[model samples]
Target: MVTDRFNSLGRPARLVALCLLVVAVAFLVLGRWDLALAIGAGALLGWVLLKPVRITWAIFAVAFMVPVTIDLGYPTNPSYTLLLVLFVLAGWGRLHRAERDGWPPRRIGAALLLPFCAVLAGVLHWHGVKPVVVGVAPLLCIGVLGWHLIEEARRDPKLILRIAEVFTWVSVAVAALAKYQTLTGTWPLFDQFAYDWTYTSVFDPTRAAGFFGHPIVYGSFAMAMALVSLTIRGRYWYVPFTANLIGLVLSGTRSAWVGTALALGIWLLLNVRKIAWRGVATGVIITVVAFAAVAVNPSTFRIGTSEPPPTWVSPTEPGTKPSPSPSTSSVDSVGVAGARMSDPVGSASASARFERIAVAWDGITRDWSTVIFGNGPESSVRYLEDVGIGDGQAQVFDNTYLTIWHNFGLVGLLSLLGLLLALFWRSRSLAGRLIIVGFAAQIFFFDVWLWLSAVGVLLLAVALGAAEDRPWPTLPFLNGLRKRRPRAPETSDASTPGFAAAA
Candidate 1:
């Protein structure tokens, strides 16, 4: 009777406990050790209620609201660190009670392990312990959370849909904030960072960033979640989807626009067999509404939307093209970063990308060992620092595959590809695969696979889910321990008869 009653109220108690824990931890990390102890006590007292789903929502909140690394000496971000600890602890609470379901086969496990092993090898061979930990901690932490979510999903097939709904609500909140920022020109959370300072625009109000550090991540993630919204069940799905699309356009990220369109086009083609007419109509309506919003608020939303592609011109010299005019290269600014300007030569967006590719190729070929094991991230940084480009050094290769190839060598790059292909094999949803496709394309434009980029978490979670993690029981500290029964004694006569096989 007591167990039954406790079970009835367990969920709510847990939710409260989880909230207290986050507050406590946030305070503690911020140096309020006294308040931390108090709130932590509340969480410990209500331990039974901490659920994986609840913890995940909390993680989502932290990821969106405080994506930046807290003002700590360590490179780890507060959200990443807190989410890692809280998620693992909360998930540990139920692991012993769950049942095994849809676990991956040995071959698939081996396939996934390949990429990790490659990275580990790189860590050991190139980067020392401390540097590697600082470099790879966020990715590892998020990957662990992904596996945790997968385990929970195995116990309940509906978990994926529920997660999708959570993602939609988060997107809705971000969209609302984006609209507010659009109107005010100042982001409430960013503290005096007016829209003009961070985002580009043709009018007073510029491209929006929701709650993210950059407009690019905000738009990309919104579009990705918009895709997720369509896959979920609900008549109101269109609402969030439209809102995210509006946010996406308001971001004014050209790469995002192209990448999202490509992903949606792929999703539509593959889902043609199973998709409903309502879903199709709803997608059309969402697209139309988003574009309509762009049309309605030309002053607020227009950035690169009205500009036509730059025309290709003949070289003025033997092998040199004319530099972009000041109008093309520079925008007026009255902010701290000052008037930002794109480089007209080597650092120019178009020229810089090609220059980076050349630099990456040169770095990898500098030594034979680097081609096999690849250059380390630290070494890559060092190499870029030495190789003078413009006034600054080039740190990125401007391509995801190139970055991976430069870091992990041919073996690691191949393993990474295998892992990605295997993830696609395990994934059942076309939309899920489409998300992968979108990021794969976007990486060519910018390297987002590292650290806490939106795609970083999304890719890991979706991939782990597709891998079909097995659920396990998370036992209580002492009460859930298995008890052994005593063995029964055998008769001496039966033992004697069997000793010599006497028949």
Candidate 2:
């Protein structure tokens, strides 16, 4: 009866049954039902679609689902969880032949691995392993997985458009949700200020964070999606494009705004001959109108929301913690008046970021050993406590470059710069180059690497931009920019009607 029932299953069904059976056995052995079930489900799906599923698709999927992290009473999110499952499935060779294809071109691979080597050296020198592990976990899960996707993109040029379409549509939904959250003052993952999100009024007016945990992250992501959506080529493409732009403005993150402008400007400059004048003019008109709308309502469109002042305990009197400082003095940012591109330096947030850099420089260069090898991964929290920079809660250095230098010293910083340079140099399309330069510029404003969603967006950008010397697809107008394939030497048979056209 069992044999007959097993025979009744079709080929695909039989494979799925076998996959589930294997997963069941593994689950019984591993014994973490939540993780096991999640991974098993992912693996089953991957195995079923093994013939068609590529690593690039998985990367894009992770990027799209960043707003939907499944909480399991831990700090973990969907980005890490999904990437972990992909990594495991890759290990089994049931998905992503990028492994067999030798993932991550050599120079990029070396750049990716240097930080881990530095971390290992630090751990051997008696630095805590837990912090390094925690800090590098995302690197292992997201960074390496992303590199594999990039390698895949390099191999399959057509896959870039597929990835971009998936990302663009999903980002439209994300932007819509951000708009909803901003207008309603409520959202599904609204745990930013404990039980209520209304406390944002204590600073500047509320900014839309979506499910990305922070307004800055949401803004940056929206900026990226907007840029990608520009490549979309339908009569209604502007709908998603405009949606992301609205999301970016509602986020009230000046850095992201600046990044978007910088990226667009750079891309335009790079492709001046390729793009049409009408498109640029239309875009400028739209952007100006959007800015004007925001400017008209400056009260609610404020950027640079102030954070609470750090509690001070005087060294002279060890027993007392002072009361909160003056309201004006307590403002951590330049408020609404200073929220323009003309005066980013005037903002208190920018000033604080500069101050952090100065402090980090002093700490990082205290000794030759620290300069060369770094204090350790995730040592910024300890450094912050030692230097009195808002206790250990202020983990990020507010500058990704600074964070890298602090965590891995000059070695790590140089390694990161090298990787960025490689990406920019290797990326053939204008879009890819813009993404690289834009990310490089934005890292100065905040710690771009601390968030998984942000990293996923970066990876997605890399994949779309990794097309080999081809003009980005989707825009028929850009077809003229594509390089003409060299023609084979003409023969007598070439003129014959019977000759099939080259694919």
**Evaluated with TM-score, which candidate comes out highest?**
2
* Minimal lDDT window, size 10, model 2: 494-503
- Candidate 1 root-mean-square deviation in Å: 14.7
Each candidate structure's TM-score, on Cα atoms with residue i matched to residue i, is: 0.66, 0.71
lDDT of the structure predicted as candidate 2? 0.60
| Runs in model 2 lying further than 4 Å from the true structure | 1-55, 68-70, 74-83, 89-108, 120-125, 191-205, 231-235, 273-277, 288-343, 385-388, 391-393, 471-503
lDDT, residue 450, candidate 2: 43
lDDT agreement of model 1 with the native: 0.55
In model 2, the Cα lDDT at residue 19 comes to 71
lDDT digits (tens) for residues 1-503 of candidate 1: 95675567668665775677688889978998867865664464234335555554444544555444222222354445554554465345335434544334553354345346446646646656654554455445544555555555555546565656677777888887776655444455453332222222222235567767566678668877777776544568878888888777666555676677887776566455666888679668777877665445323356755532222333577634233222221111112112122322333465777878888888777677778777754455556667656623235666767766777676666766775665554654545666766666666767664424464446433633453333212223321332242333575443221111211
Residue 40 local lDDT, model 1: 64
Q: How far is candidate 2 from the true structure (C-alpha RMSD, Å)?
A: 9.0
